[model samples]
Target: MTIHLSKSRLKYLSRLGLFLFLLILSGLFYASCNTQSSRNQSGKAHLGESPMTDSMVVDQLIQRSRSFYEETGMRAEPFDRFLQEAMEIASRHNLLWQQVRILNTIGRRYRDRSAYGEALRYHNRALTIAQNINNKGLLSEVYNQIGVVFRRTDDNAIALDMHFKALRLAEETRDSFNISVAINSIGNVNANLGRYHSAIEYFLRALEYADRLDNTLGKAINNHNIGECRLKMGYPEEALEYFQKSLAYNNQIGSRAGQSICYNSIGAVYIAKDDPVTALEYLERALNINDRLGDLMQVSISHSKIGEVYLLLGDFAKADDHLNKSYELAKNIGSRFQAEESLRLLSRLHEANHNYATSLEYFKTATAYRDSILNEKNINHLTTMEAMLETEAQRNRIYQLNQMTSEQLITLGRQRLMLTIIIIIFVILAVITTLLIYQHRLRIKYNNLKNQHKLLRSQMNPHFIFNALSAIQVYVLEHDVEKSTKFLTDFAKLMRLVLKTSHHDFIPLKDESEILKYYLELQKLRFVSPFNYQITIDEGLDQENTFVPPMLTQPFVENAVEHGVRLMENQGHLDIRFKKLNTQMVVEVEDNGIGISSSIDQKQKSGINKKHESMAIKITKERLDVIRNDIGGKVSLEIIDKKNINPFDRGTLIRIILPIVSQNN
Candidate 1:
């Protein structure tokens, strides 16, 4: 049946019986690949949801994005800036997974926007990162995302194969959410192959899992699939049943897009039964949703359906009007199914009116699209298979591991030398276990550091940009042209520094310290004389060689100025000191302003986080989760005199410590 189990489904293996059998036979956990890294959000915005609804914004965003790229054949600078910003945020805080996740999101967005080539690039970048970290989850997600692109490109076979691999990973990972998705994807491929029964079975299986997972969106999608198959089988009544149910589900979830799809499919069924009036009503409703959502794919499909209805109604001119519109959209988006459907309907409409030449032209176009679709499916199938076979080969490697474990044990009776060797091996195993524990700890440490770096990077820029722009605006408003010009120039230079550092693996301590000063200077312009500051860098400190996190210390300084100094009655004195003590390099920024209040918890802290003071702090903590691996040096944020700090704090003190490095090339 080629019913590949996704990692999420693999989690059910024990309960499902398949996993238990494999586990008992293998004597170790065989990876059910929950490799699909991203999860399908249940139908929050159904195909039936209104395009104008807030929920449809995401779909709308993708649709507009695709049009922009397709027509220009280029991505806008703002889009790239957003991506770059995401990267910067990830890098400064050292959040590798978050970075990869954001990259995946961008790729998915691009793919939906019909920027396949860009989508592929971002997906590959994410894949490469996931591979380096051996993050099976992330790798699975990238594969599934890549597979989705292929599916959209009309390489159904290849898409199916990639989806199978993704399913295996999802199963291995026990990710039920994506398992249902992978299952439905396979059903789609089978449907394309004309295996309607098999497709129904797959969809039904997906529905079972969806029900268990409480995934309403998945259920609706399955319903839609069932409706399509039934319609194809000439069961308009049955198709209507599924379509209506799907619409209800979509309505429950507020999925306008889902609603649109249901309407379109239902209209198609009615049209097949030669009920043009009902068809037009439903198709018109579908078109309204499509126009709002701006879903080009659905737009193409809806137009074709509308044209078919018009043709059947014997409205030659109206049918031709809709057909030409559908044809352009279908060709532009590369939807063979829509293109062919539109062309065929156009041919019939023309022939009915005795336009033989026009009808022949459309017939030829439909034939060409049909052939193109067929060729695409064939190539896609082969590609999908190649990936599946390679993954299967990886499974074979697991067998080799099993064989090795078996060979390591003596099958024959025990001997004196053998007994001694066994003891030694056991001891070695214990030592290795300890080493792995230590290594895991180290990994956690590095991961935390990586996360910390990313947070700092994310926090710094927006803060700087905001303050800089404010200063520039204030000067320009006062007609201080030269000052306004200077502020912008400085902002530009700082921005350049930020851009340069964004791509780097690390930055010099000197440059890192300098960034904080520029950041502080920008802030000073905003508050006027709200705060005062001092800077101390230890003598003989290797300015060029000493490494410090970019923007790591800036937040603390800014926090002190905004929350600590601004609240105080007296002149707020902010002190910054950097010193290398033995192997440890410490940077302390202390402020004498209003103290932190004991009443307010960390979560309520304002002016610090991007969202809240605590948000920035929490983000930093989450990002530093990787650092839990290392027990050595540390980075921390603590209010020195907790009682002295206030929500209207006198001021705050932040101390950061890290290992000092001597080498810089």
Candidate 2:
């Protein structure tokens, strides 16, 4: 077992217990390597007959797995079973954070084996658990692991998204290890995408963090990634320096996986230098270590590189053998990338050997895989563009921060003071502006009230009063004293009601409805051809508690009665409805007589020379506009001609929407 513990994880264990546990793990690994005992037997022997609590068992299992990680390195299969057992125990005990850790570990193992689908499944499970626990540290670790899986699968866009999310969460939680890991992972994606310069920037930033934490593993990883970017940027000598630095760190930490990667990277640098002899030594070293560790992904890559070197040296037989093994291992691990490279090398080797037909077949298959990969790369380009823009912005922000000075601090303070002064000035201007607007609105309201009083005084036109008085006198001369007295009394009541309520801004719906009834009755009395009128209020309305602007609907109702219902040759009908619609009140005055358009044309032909516009209507609309402006409420007047709906139908329908104002109890 190869076990590696993070600095943060190691903080949980006492030095004495960790040392003792390492001693036991070393002996067990030694015995397993020598075939003295089965791996399962060794693990059980260490944990058997212990009366530890569930938490202790989980801790021991986790520590044991960590030891396996160190000893066997990235070849984590030997410890995977123990970790699964730990996961089961932790789940049974509802140890949520333990489950997240175990899931992330297993996911990484799957990632190492190039089982991307299974890796994502485990990581997603970890992500869900971490989110449920609301633990930023666990969430960051899981996001970083998921990002690595996507990067390996050549999904750079998703990889960048995941890595950035991990970086943000790690920064929020001050998880230094994860922050470095996430930044380094982003660099790897950029390097693979051919953005070597951008990749180098990220690598250097990540290195700064790793150095601060003195995290040997983080340092090795960042150094190796920087080497990759440099090598891709065509700086083989510079790349060698970084690779050596990484190798030394890995050696110090005894990281077999990290050492393997450094060896492979160095080999690649030598290959770029056209030094096959030197490259072969490093390539073989990586192959041996990866083969021993059972990391098929790295093993495949190593074989492909070694085979390429052999082909370069004109060693066809050795090249064919290595390339075939590389392809087989890559295919078994589902690594299409490695398989494609191996197939391409094999095609070249066959071509060199004059095997034209076989070479062509290999070339065709490799092309198919390459085409599919290119299609995936096209999708990645969209994310690549976005990542480039974001990375540039991040660089600018970092540069600005790094360039800050004492003088800049003084300038910043001055700017802040200026901003405060500007805000105070703006506030004063806003208050003055508000007062001026209020004064202007008050003047407008005063003029509207004046017009309203004038319209109300005009409501009792001499023509209407004279007509009512003449009707009363006719009833008196006909000796109908009771009818005369009743008509006179009703007319007086209507006049008084309108005068009393006209001065108020708002009156109760009950009082307003009473005024409308009284006016309609007096008008009905004056009509020679009598009309029936109905006024209804919605049952749901609390008429006494709800108030509306006084007489808002009176003009429209008067128009309907006078122009629409009064001119009918047959029996006329007037219907007024006050209904509630949601938060607004709806008032509808519908009359069946001559429609509004017809009445206008009739009056024009009859030489009624006055303009058709009613003063009462004009004043009422101004009042509604004021109401609408002041309260920002819905107040509208819509007149619908029934003749437009059907030519034979004659009537006008008036709808007034008023804001509902109710007194709070």
Query: What lDDT is obtained when candidate 1 is compared to the true structure?
Result: 0.70
- Error at 331, model 2, angstroms: 4.3
TM-score of each: 0.44, 0.46
Q: Tell me the whole-model lDDT of each prediction, alpha carbons only.
A: 0.70, 0.80
Model 2 lDDT per residue over 60-113, tens place = 898899887767755458337789899888776677777787888777776775
Predicted model with the maximum TM-score: 2
lDDT of 1 at 139: 71
- Give per-residue CA lDDT, model 1, range 1-665, as digits (tens): 01112222333332435443444434322321222222122222111222333323333444564555545442353255445554564555445665576677777766755556566666666765676566667677777887787777667776888789879888899888778888898888888878899999999999999999988999899999988998898899999999998999999999998899889888888888878899899999999998887777788788888887888777878888888899998888777878899899888988999999999999998999899877765665554455445545755776688688766644532453476467656655565565556556655655565555654564354655676787788899999998787677766666677666754435787777777676666667677665678889998578887765466566567667766776666677889999878877778888876655521344265434444345465655543332222223565555574344444444457776666655532
RMSD of each: 37.9, 30.3
lDDT of 1 at 71: 52
